[model samples]
Target: MAESNIHTLVHKETITLFPVDYRISRHAIFLINRNNIDSPLPLLSEIMRSKGFKVTTDQEKADYIMRITSYVTMPTNKNDQALPYSAEFLLSMREKLPVIKPLLVQSGDSPGEQMKATAKLVHNSNQGILGSDASNIISLGSTFGGGAGGLIAGAAASVIDTTASIFSRNSIREGLAGFEFSMTKNSGFLNQVSGLNVYAASATPEKPEALLDAAIGRAAAEMERD
Candidate 1:
Protein backbone atom coordinates (compact mmCIF):
# COMPACT_ATOMS: atom_id res chain seq x y z
CA MET A 1 0.00 0.00 0.00
CA ALA A 2 1.69 3.15 -1.20
CA GLU A 3 0.97 6.51 0.47
CA SER A 4 -1.68 8.48 -1.39
CA ASN A 5 -0.67 11.89 -2.67
CA ILE A 6 -3.64 13.72 -1.18
CA HIS A 7 -2.78 17.29 -0.43
CA THR A 8 -5.06 20.30 -0.01
CA LEU A 9 -3.75 23.63 -1.20
CA VAL A 10 -5.38 26.14 1.11
CA HIS A 11 -5.25 29.40 -0.79
CA LYS A 12 -3.98 32.59 0.86
CA GLU A 13 -5.76 35.92 1.39
CA THR A 14 -5.48 39.32 3.14
CA ILE A 15 -7.55 41.34 5.71
CA THR A 16 -7.30 45.10 5.94
CA LEU A 17 -9.30 48.07 7.32
CA PHE A 18 -9.05 51.82 6.68
CA PRO A 19 -10.57 54.78 8.46
CA VAL A 20 -12.37 57.30 6.23
CA ASP A 21 -12.00 60.28 8.54
CA TYR A 22 -8.77 62.26 8.15
CA ARG A 23 -9.11 64.09 11.47
CA ILE A 24 -8.19 61.00 13.48
CA SER A 25 -4.78 60.20 12.00
CA ARG A 26 -3.11 60.41 15.43
CA HIS A 27 -5.54 57.95 16.93
CA ALA A 28 -5.21 55.64 13.95
CA ILE A 29 -1.40 55.68 14.24
CA PHE A 30 -1.60 54.93 17.95
CA LEU A 31 -4.04 52.07 17.39
CA ILE A 32 -1.84 50.57 14.67
CA ASN A 33 1.58 51.35 16.19
CA ARG A 34 0.86 51.83 19.95
CA ASN A 35 -1.84 51.55 22.60
CA ASN A 36 -3.25 48.10 21.98
CA ILE A 37 -0.46 48.54 19.51
CA ASP A 38 0.21 45.17 17.94
CA SER A 39 -1.02 44.84 14.37
CA PRO A 40 -4.27 42.91 13.82
CA LEU A 41 -2.67 41.35 10.73
CA PRO A 42 -0.58 38.84 12.72
CA LEU A 43 -3.48 38.01 14.95
CA LEU A 44 -5.62 37.11 11.95
CA SER A 45 -2.77 35.13 10.42
CA GLU A 46 -2.34 33.02 13.57
CA ILE A 47 -6.05 32.33 13.67
CA MET A 48 -6.03 31.05 10.09
CA ARG A 49 -2.96 28.88 10.73
CA SER A 50 -4.76 27.05 13.56
CA LYS A 51 -7.28 25.81 11.00
CA GLY A 52 -4.68 24.01 8.91
CA PHE A 53 -4.42 26.78 6.38
CA LYS A 54 -1.33 28.50 5.00
CA VAL A 55 -1.06 32.17 5.87
CA THR A 56 0.94 34.72 3.92
CA THR A 57 1.49 38.49 4.08
CA ASP A 58 2.39 38.83 0.43
CA GLN A 59 -0.58 39.59 -1.81
CA GLU A 60 1.12 37.96 -4.74
CA LYS A 61 1.24 34.67 -2.88
CA ALA A 62 -2.35 34.76 -1.65
CA ASP A 63 -5.43 33.12 -3.13
CA TYR A 64 -7.85 35.63 -1.69
CA ILE A 65 -7.98 39.12 -0.14
CA MET A 66 -10.00 40.55 2.77
CA ARG A 67 -10.31 44.27 3.34
CA ILE A 68 -11.85 45.93 6.44
CA THR A 69 -12.98 49.54 6.81
CA SER A 70 -13.84 51.05 10.19
CA TYR A 71 -14.80 54.41 11.69
CA VAL A 72 -14.44 55.50 15.37
CA THR A 73 -15.73 58.62 17.00
CA MET A 74 -14.97 60.51 20.24
CA PRO A 75 -17.77 62.98 20.75
CA THR A 76 -17.00 66.69 21.05
CA ASN A 77 -20.64 67.72 20.78
CA LYS A 78 -22.62 68.29 23.96
CA ASN A 79 -25.73 66.64 22.54
CA ASP A 80 -24.04 63.28 23.03
CA GLN A 81 -24.08 62.87 19.30
CA ALA A 82 -24.16 59.29 18.23
CA LEU A 83 -21.05 59.30 16.09
CA PRO A 84 -21.25 57.18 12.97
CA TYR A 85 -18.92 54.21 12.59
CA SER A 86 -18.62 51.52 9.97
CA ALA A 87 -16.65 48.39 8.94
CA GLU A 88 -16.31 47.14 5.42
CA PHE A 89 -14.67 43.78 4.68
CA LEU A 90 -13.97 42.52 1.19
CA LEU A 91 -13.04 38.85 0.83
CA SER A 92 -11.83 37.97 -2.65
CA MET A 93 -11.02 34.38 -3.59
CA ARG A 94 -9.58 33.01 -6.78
CA GLU A 95 -12.16 33.15 -9.58
CA LYS A 96 -10.75 30.16 -11.40
CA LEU A 97 -10.04 28.02 -8.34
CA PRO A 98 -12.21 24.99 -7.72
CA VAL A 99 -12.16 25.04 -3.91
CA ILE A 100 -12.70 28.68 -3.16
CA LYS A 101 -15.07 31.57 -3.98
CA PRO A 102 -14.83 35.31 -3.50
CA LEU A 103 -16.97 37.31 -1.03
CA LEU A 104 -17.50 40.81 0.34
CA VAL A 105 -18.72 41.81 3.84
CA GLN A 106 -19.64 45.35 4.96
CA SER A 107 -21.21 46.92 8.15
CA GLY A 108 -21.82 50.27 9.84
CA ASP A 109 -23.24 51.86 13.05
CA SER A 110 -24.38 55.17 14.60
CA PRO A 111 -23.49 56.65 17.98
CA GLY A 112 -25.15 55.92 21.42
CA GLU A 113 -26.63 52.56 22.41
CA GLN A 114 -26.98 51.73 18.74
CA MET A 115 -23.21 51.60 18.70
CA LYS A 116 -23.27 48.61 21.02
CA ALA A 117 -26.34 47.01 19.53
CA THR A 118 -25.42 43.68 17.96
CA ALA A 119 -28.26 42.30 15.94
CA LYS A 120 -27.15 40.26 12.95
CA LEU A 121 -29.12 42.06 10.26
CA VAL A 122 -28.26 40.46 6.89
CA HIS A 123 -28.59 36.88 8.14
CA ASN A 124 -31.99 37.57 9.58
CA SER A 125 -33.05 38.86 6.23
CA ASN A 126 -32.32 35.59 4.39
CA GLN A 127 -30.81 32.11 4.42
CA GLY A 128 -27.62 30.73 2.84
CA ILE A 129 -25.68 33.73 4.10
CA LEU A 130 -23.50 32.04 6.73
CA GLY A 131 -21.76 28.63 6.97
CA SER A 132 -24.79 26.75 8.38
CA ASP A 133 -24.29 28.05 11.95
CA ALA A 134 -22.66 30.62 14.22
CA SER A 135 -19.67 28.36 14.86
CA ASN A 136 -18.77 28.67 11.20
CA ILE A 137 -18.31 32.41 11.51
CA ILE A 138 -14.93 33.98 12.34
CA SER A 139 -14.19 35.90 15.52
CA LEU A 140 -11.58 38.61 14.90
CA GLY A 141 -10.69 39.04 18.61
CA SER A 142 -11.25 42.01 20.95
CA THR A 143 -10.07 45.64 20.75
CA PHE A 144 -9.67 48.52 23.24
CA GLY A 145 -11.22 52.03 23.42
CA GLY A 146 -14.93 52.81 23.04
CA GLY A 147 -14.61 54.08 19.51
CA ALA A 148 -12.49 51.19 18.34
CA GLY A 149 -14.69 48.80 20.25
CA GLY A 150 -17.73 50.22 18.54
CA LEU A 151 -16.08 50.04 15.14
CA ILE A 152 -15.06 46.42 15.63
CA ALA A 153 -18.48 45.54 16.97
CA GLY A 154 -20.20 47.17 14.04
CA ALA A 155 -17.92 45.37 11.60
CA ALA A 156 -18.45 41.99 13.23
CA ALA A 157 -22.16 42.48 13.18
CA SER A 158 -21.96 43.59 9.58
CA VAL A 159 -19.92 40.53 8.60
CA ILE A 160 -22.55 38.29 10.09
CA ASP A 161 -25.24 40.21 8.30
CA THR A 162 -23.38 40.34 5.01
CA THR A 163 -22.47 36.67 5.22
CA ALA A 164 -26.13 35.82 5.60
CA SER A 165 -27.09 38.18 2.85
CA ILE A 166 -24.58 36.54 0.55
CA PHE A 167 -25.96 33.05 1.16
CA SER A 168 -29.69 33.66 1.40
CA ARG A 169 -31.26 37.06 1.25
CA ASN A 170 -33.66 35.85 3.94
CA SER A 171 -31.94 33.81 6.62
CA ILE A 172 -33.76 33.06 9.86
CA ARG A 173 -31.03 33.07 12.48
CA GLU A 174 -29.29 36.39 12.80
CA GLY A 175 -25.65 35.28 13.08
CA LEU A 176 -24.20 36.36 16.50
CA ALA A 177 -24.54 39.49 18.54
CA GLY A 178 -22.46 41.52 21.05
CA PHE A 179 -19.27 39.67 20.17
CA GLU A 180 -17.05 42.72 20.67
CA PHE A 181 -16.00 43.37 24.28
CA SER A 182 -14.03 46.36 25.56
CA MET A 183 -10.64 45.96 27.27
CA THR A 184 -10.40 49.48 28.78
CA LYS A 185 -12.62 52.25 30.12
CA ASN A 186 -13.03 55.62 28.43
CA SER A 187 -10.85 58.17 30.27
CA GLY A 188 -8.33 61.02 30.11
CA PHE A 189 -8.17 64.06 27.83
CA LEU A 190 -6.42 61.97 25.24
CA ASN A 191 -9.49 59.78 25.05
CA GLN A 192 -11.55 62.89 24.45
CA VAL A 193 -9.38 64.20 21.64
CA SER A 194 -8.63 60.76 20.32
CA GLY A 195 -12.12 59.29 20.36
CA LEU A 196 -11.93 56.15 18.27
CA ASN A 197 -9.53 56.21 15.36
CA VAL A 198 -10.62 54.04 12.44
CA TYR A 199 -8.29 51.48 10.86
CA ALA A 200 -8.78 49.32 7.78
CA ALA A 201 -6.68 46.99 5.63
CA SER A 202 -6.52 45.42 2.20
CA ALA A 203 -4.30 42.42 2.80
CA THR A 204 -4.17 38.77 1.91
CA PRO A 205 -6.51 36.64 4.01
CA GLU A 206 -3.72 34.64 5.60
CA LYS A 207 -4.32 36.02 9.10
CA PRO A 208 -7.17 35.03 11.40
CA GLU A 209 -6.53 31.56 10.09
CA ALA A 210 -9.81 30.16 11.36
CA LEU A 211 -11.80 32.73 9.42
CA LEU A 212 -9.87 31.99 6.26
CA ASP A 213 -10.53 28.24 6.51
CA ALA A 214 -14.16 28.68 7.44
CA ALA A 215 -14.73 31.09 4.62
CA ILE A 216 -12.86 28.89 2.19
CA GLY A 217 -14.66 25.78 3.35
CA ARG A 218 -18.00 27.46 2.99
CA ALA A 219 -17.16 28.63 -0.48
CA ALA A 220 -15.88 25.21 -1.44
CA ALA A 221 -19.06 23.55 -0.26
CA GLU A 222 -21.19 26.11 -2.05
CA MET A 223 -19.23 25.58 -5.22
CA GLU A 224 -19.74 21.83 -5.02
CA ARG A 225 -23.50 22.39 -4.82
CA ASP A 226 -23.34 24.49 -7.96
Candidate 2:
Protein backbone atom coordinates (compact mmCIF):
# COMPACT_ATOMS: atom_id res chain seq x y z
CA MET A 1 0.00 0.00 0.00
CA ALA A 2 1.16 3.58 -0.73
CA GLU A 3 1.99 5.81 2.31
CA SER A 4 1.66 9.56 2.88
CA ASN A 5 4.50 11.99 3.51
CA ILE A 6 2.74 14.89 5.21
CA HIS A 7 4.65 16.30 8.20
CA THR A 8 2.64 17.78 11.06
CA LEU A 9 3.01 18.32 14.81
CA VAL A 10 0.78 15.29 15.35
CA HIS A 11 -0.60 13.18 12.47
CA LYS A 12 -3.41 10.58 12.65
CA GLU A 13 -5.88 9.02 10.18
CA THR A 14 -8.24 6.01 9.93
CA ILE A 15 -8.15 4.81 6.37
CA THR A 16 -11.15 2.96 4.90
CA LEU A 17 -10.92 -0.83 5.18
CA PHE A 18 -13.02 -3.98 5.56
CA PRO A 19 -13.19 -5.94 8.85
CA VAL A 20 -10.87 -8.88 9.51
CA ASP A 21 -10.91 -11.53 12.25
CA TYR A 22 -7.81 -10.75 14.31
CA ARG A 23 -8.21 -13.68 16.70
CA ILE A 24 -7.68 -16.39 14.13
CA SER A 25 -4.17 -15.58 12.94
CA ARG A 26 -2.36 -12.62 14.47
CA HIS A 27 1.42 -12.42 14.62
CA ALA A 28 3.90 -9.56 14.56
CA ILE A 29 7.62 -8.86 14.90
CA PHE A 30 9.64 -5.82 15.88
CA LEU A 31 12.62 -4.34 14.03
CA ILE A 32 14.00 -1.70 16.37
CA ASN A 33 17.57 -0.55 16.78
CA ARG A 34 19.32 -1.59 20.02
CA ASN A 35 22.07 0.97 19.76
CA ASN A 36 19.92 3.71 21.25
CA ILE A 37 18.22 1.42 23.75
CA ASP A 38 19.09 -0.93 26.54
CA SER A 39 17.52 -4.36 25.90
CA PRO A 40 14.15 -2.92 24.91
CA LEU A 41 13.04 -5.73 22.64
CA PRO A 42 11.71 -7.81 25.50
CA LEU A 43 9.86 -4.84 26.92
CA LEU A 44 8.37 -4.17 23.48
CA SER A 45 7.31 -7.82 23.26
CA GLU A 46 5.60 -7.64 26.64
CA ILE A 47 3.75 -4.48 25.70
CA MET A 48 2.45 -6.07 22.51
CA ARG A 49 1.52 -9.14 24.51
CA SER A 50 -0.73 -6.96 26.65
CA LYS A 51 -2.58 -5.97 23.45
CA GLY A 52 -3.15 -9.65 22.63
CA PHE A 53 -0.70 -9.89 19.77
CA LYS A 54 1.72 -12.76 19.29
CA VAL A 55 5.30 -11.58 19.43
CA THR A 56 7.63 -13.60 17.29
CA THR A 57 11.38 -13.45 17.05
CA ASP A 58 11.19 -15.39 13.82
CA GLN A 59 10.67 -12.71 11.20
CA GLU A 60 9.27 -15.21 8.70
CA LYS A 61 6.37 -16.10 10.97
CA ALA A 62 5.35 -12.53 11.58
CA ASP A 63 2.19 -11.32 9.86
CA TYR A 64 3.47 -7.78 10.17
CA ILE A 65 6.78 -6.10 10.93
CA MET A 66 7.27 -3.05 13.13
CA ARG A 67 10.16 -0.71 12.42
CA ILE A 68 11.14 2.37 14.38
CA THR A 69 12.84 5.38 12.80
CA SER A 70 14.17 8.26 14.86
CA TYR A 71 15.61 11.68 14.10
CA VAL A 72 17.01 14.63 16.06
CA THR A 73 16.67 18.25 15.05
CA MET A 74 19.47 20.39 16.45
CA PRO A 75 18.63 23.71 18.07
CA THR A 76 18.90 26.25 15.25
CA ASN A 77 18.82 29.64 16.95
CA LYS A 78 19.01 31.34 13.54
CA ASN A 79 15.85 29.55 12.31
CA ASP A 80 14.13 29.74 15.72
CA GLN A 81 13.80 25.96 15.80
CA ALA A 82 14.00 24.06 19.09
CA LEU A 83 15.81 20.79 19.36
CA PRO A 84 13.46 17.98 18.26
CA TYR A 85 14.56 14.47 19.20
CA SER A 86 11.87 12.14 18.02
CA ALA A 87 11.15 8.56 17.01
CA GLU A 88 8.56 7.10 14.66
CA PHE A 89 7.25 3.55 14.52
CA LEU A 90 6.03 2.06 11.25
CA LEU A 91 3.99 -1.07 10.64
CA SER A 92 4.49 -3.08 7.45
CA MET A 93 2.00 -5.85 6.98
CA ARG A 94 2.53 -8.90 4.84
CA GLU A 95 -0.10 -10.00 2.32
CA LYS A 96 -3.18 -7.89 1.52
CA LEU A 97 -4.94 -7.30 4.81
CA PRO A 98 -8.33 -5.71 5.17
CA VAL A 99 -7.27 -2.79 7.40
CA ILE A 100 -3.96 -1.52 8.74
CA LYS A 101 -4.05 1.74 10.64
CA PRO A 102 -1.60 3.96 12.50
CA LEU A 103 -3.24 3.83 15.89
CA LEU A 104 -0.86 6.44 17.39
CA VAL A 105 2.26 8.50 16.52
CA GLN A 106 4.12 10.30 19.36
CA SER A 107 7.25 12.42 19.48
CA GLY A 108 9.14 14.08 22.30
CA ASP A 109 12.32 16.04 23.00
CA SER A 110 13.48 13.53 25.62
CA PRO A 111 13.02 9.81 26.04
CA GLY A 112 11.53 10.04 29.53
CA GLU A 113 8.81 12.43 28.47
CA GLN A 114 8.01 10.24 25.52
CA MET A 115 7.58 7.22 27.78
CA LYS A 116 5.03 8.97 29.97
CA ALA A 117 3.05 10.03 26.93
CA THR A 118 3.27 6.55 25.52
CA ALA A 119 1.87 5.06 28.74
CA LYS A 120 -1.07 7.43 28.59
CA LEU A 121 -1.73 6.63 24.94
CA VAL A 122 -1.67 2.92 25.65
CA HIS A 123 -4.01 3.36 28.61
CA ASN A 124 -6.46 5.32 26.47
CA SER A 125 -6.25 3.19 23.34
CA ASN A 126 -6.72 0.13 25.47
CA GLN A 127 -9.30 1.99 27.56
CA GLY A 128 -11.87 -0.72 27.54
CA ILE A 129 -10.79 -4.32 27.49
CA LEU A 130 -9.34 -5.68 24.26
CA GLY A 131 -11.09 -7.93 21.74
CA SER A 132 -14.72 -9.07 22.20
CA ASP A 133 -14.49 -8.35 25.91
CA ALA A 134 -14.05 -4.62 25.28
CA SER A 135 -16.72 -2.10 26.37
CA ASN A 136 -17.43 1.24 28.16
CA ILE A 137 -19.49 2.48 31.08
CA ILE A 138 -21.88 5.49 31.22
CA SER A 139 -24.25 6.73 33.92
CA LEU A 140 -27.46 8.69 33.36
CA GLY A 141 -30.03 10.50 35.52
CA SER A 142 -33.32 12.37 35.06
CA THR A 143 -35.58 14.69 37.06
CA PHE A 144 -39.37 14.89 37.19
CA GLY A 145 -41.73 17.87 37.32
CA GLY A 146 -44.33 17.94 40.13
CA GLY A 147 -46.49 20.80 38.88
CA ALA A 148 -49.17 21.30 36.14
CA GLY A 149 -48.06 18.86 33.43
CA GLY A 150 -47.03 16.40 36.13
CA LEU A 151 -50.67 15.22 36.52
CA ILE A 152 -52.61 13.36 33.83
CA ALA A 153 -55.30 15.33 31.94
CA GLY A 154 -58.97 14.54 32.63
CA ALA A 155 -57.87 11.89 35.12
CA ALA A 156 -58.85 11.71 38.78
CA ALA A 157 -55.15 11.78 39.63
CA SER A 158 -54.34 13.68 42.84
CA VAL A 159 -51.07 15.35 43.84
CA ILE A 160 -50.43 12.52 46.30
CA ASP A 161 -50.76 9.90 43.54
CA THR A 162 -48.53 11.90 41.21
CA THR A 163 -45.97 12.33 43.93
CA ALA A 164 -46.01 8.59 44.62
CA SER A 165 -45.45 7.82 40.97
CA ILE A 166 -42.63 10.32 40.82
CA PHE A 167 -41.06 8.68 43.85
CA SER A 168 -41.30 5.29 42.13
CA ARG A 169 -39.65 6.74 39.03
CA ASN A 170 -36.87 8.13 41.15
CA SER A 171 -36.37 4.72 42.72
CA ILE A 172 -36.12 3.16 39.28
CA ARG A 173 -33.56 5.73 38.25
CA GLU A 174 -31.52 5.03 41.32
CA GLY A 175 -31.52 1.31 40.60
CA LEU A 176 -30.31 1.95 37.08
CA ALA A 177 -27.57 4.32 38.16
CA GLY A 178 -24.02 3.73 36.98
CA PHE A 179 -25.20 1.92 33.86
CA GLU A 180 -22.52 1.12 31.29
CA PHE A 181 -22.22 0.21 27.64
CA SER A 182 -19.61 -1.12 25.25
CA MET A 183 -17.30 1.33 23.47
CA THR A 184 -15.62 -1.19 21.25
CA LYS A 185 -16.03 -1.09 17.49
CA ASN A 186 -14.89 -3.08 14.50
CA SER A 187 -11.69 -1.33 13.32
CA GLY A 188 -8.36 -2.08 11.52
CA PHE A 189 -7.96 -0.55 8.13
CA LEU A 190 -5.51 1.70 6.31
CA ASN A 191 -5.61 3.70 3.12
CA GLN A 192 -3.00 3.11 0.48
CA VAL A 193 0.17 3.49 2.57
CA SER A 194 2.82 6.00 1.57
CA GLY A 195 4.76 7.29 4.59
CA LEU A 196 2.43 9.61 6.55
CA ASN A 197 0.34 7.28 8.75
CA VAL A 198 1.66 8.83 11.96
CA TYR A 199 -0.49 8.13 15.02
CA ALA A 200 0.83 10.29 17.91
CA ALA A 201 3.44 13.05 18.08
CA SER A 202 4.91 15.12 20.92
CA ALA A 203 7.53 17.84 21.27
CA THR A 204 10.03 19.30 23.83
CA PRO A 205 9.88 16.41 26.37
CA GLU A 206 10.75 12.78 25.66
CA LYS A 207 10.42 9.37 27.27
CA PRO A 208 11.39 5.82 26.35
CA GLU A 209 8.64 3.58 27.72
CA ALA A 210 6.02 5.88 26.21
CA LEU A 211 7.52 5.62 22.75
CA LEU A 212 7.89 1.86 23.00
CA ASP A 213 4.39 1.31 24.36
CA ALA A 214 2.82 3.74 21.90
CA ALA A 215 4.42 2.06 18.93
CA ILE A 216 3.68 -1.44 20.15
CA GLY A 217 0.13 -0.67 21.19
CA ARG A 218 -0.63 1.08 17.93
CA ALA A 219 0.44 -1.91 15.88
CA ALA A 220 -1.27 -4.38 18.16
CA ALA A 221 -4.52 -2.39 18.27
CA GLU A 222 -4.64 -2.44 14.48
CA MET A 223 -4.29 -6.21 14.43
CA GLU A 224 -6.46 -6.86 17.48
CA ARG A 225 -9.37 -4.69 16.33
CA ASP A 226 -12.67 -6.47 16.86
- Top candidate by lDDT: 2
Tens-digit per-residue lDDT, 81-175, candidate 1:
21212111112211211211111123352221121232233213324433112222322332323431222333566544643343443222111
Off by over 4 Å in 2: 1-19, 23-25, 28-43, 67-196, 201-208
lDDT of 1: 0.25
Which tens-of-lDDT digit does each residue in 96-157 have in candidate 2?
11111122235334433343343232223223453111111110111112321121222334
Cα displacement (Å) at residue 194, model 1: 36
Best by TM-score: 2
Q: What is the C-alpha RMSD of each candidate to the true structure, in Å?
A: 19.4, 22.6
Displacement of the residue 117 alpha carbon in candidate 2, Å? 18
Q: What does the lDDT read for residue 171 in candidate 1?
A: 26
Residue 174 shift from truth in candidate 1, angstroms:
12
